[model samples]
Target: MHYDGVDYDAGMVIGAELKNGKVSTQIGFSVQTFIVYNPANGKMELMFIIKNGQVFLRTIFIDKGTIEELLIGSVIQSKNYQAGNTGFKIDGETGIAEFNRLVINKDFKIIGDASKIVLDNTGLAVYSTSGGVIKLSRRP
Candidate 1:
């Protein structure tokens, strides 16, 4: 995963690793794009508001046991494709994974402790603790 100034090999990169806890989504005037974790269901979710002021469900996954064992799928509603599809899976416990961008260029990144996550929605009572970067590449 490569973003800003971080470059992670795609082959060994494991997707977001959310602990079993409720996570929050970023909020702001502009499109609030961030990777969140839902502790209630023990799943990680990517939250984003599109350019047209539309909120859509992006990527979701459940941490299996190891980093490589995690499974995730994306629910995207785009002009080209509008539907939920199974996403790629990481093959290693820890290495480098590509940023699962929501849109074509809107990449979300989180990086820190092996288990340090930022709180998104307070009402949801979600907490995140992991370290990884998300790079959003704007589409032309």
Candidate 2:
């Protein structure tokens, strides 16, 4: 498989990626939690959060054709979806896949050592041999 890379710094590029399936999403405020793994300079951080957002997917996998359907279907059936809190509702059907602007308040995180996450709540957490444990709990 050939992988071309583009680093995105905003949510709008999410849809743009659907067009090419070769992009990354990065935003400052969007990051809720992160962990660092390497300690040499603590440059490796794994993020764990995507809140009030959208999911634009395009995949050609050997197992399941478009994983987008699976993911969207799961979100639709989630308890939060049932509760009417999920931000995204099916807007319309695309010839390739169904599209939705997911705006739920969800969270998760990772850092130097990685971590567990929960969202709609916002906070920051980090685990590193140099820093030990540094965190800021979520707020309503």
- TM-score for predicted model 2 compared with the true structure: 0.17
**lDDT, each prediction:** 0.34, 0.34
**Candidate 2 total steric clashes:** 12
Please identify model 2 stretches exceeding 4 Å from their true place: 1-66, 71-123
Q: What are the TM-scores, per candidate, against the unseen true structure? A: 0.15, 0.17
CA error at residue 108 for candidate 1, angstroms: 54
Name the 10 consecutive residues with the lowest summed lDDT in model 2.
95-104
Candidate 1 residue lDDT tens string, 1-140: 67899865422222444457855444343223433445566655445434455445665464665565534453222233312222222323333232222222125333322221111222111122233433334345
lDDT of 2 at 15: 28
Q: Scored by Cα lDDT, where does model 2 land?
A: 0.34
Global fold similarity of model 1 (TM-score): 0.15
Q: Find the candidate with the highest TM-score and give its number.
A: 2
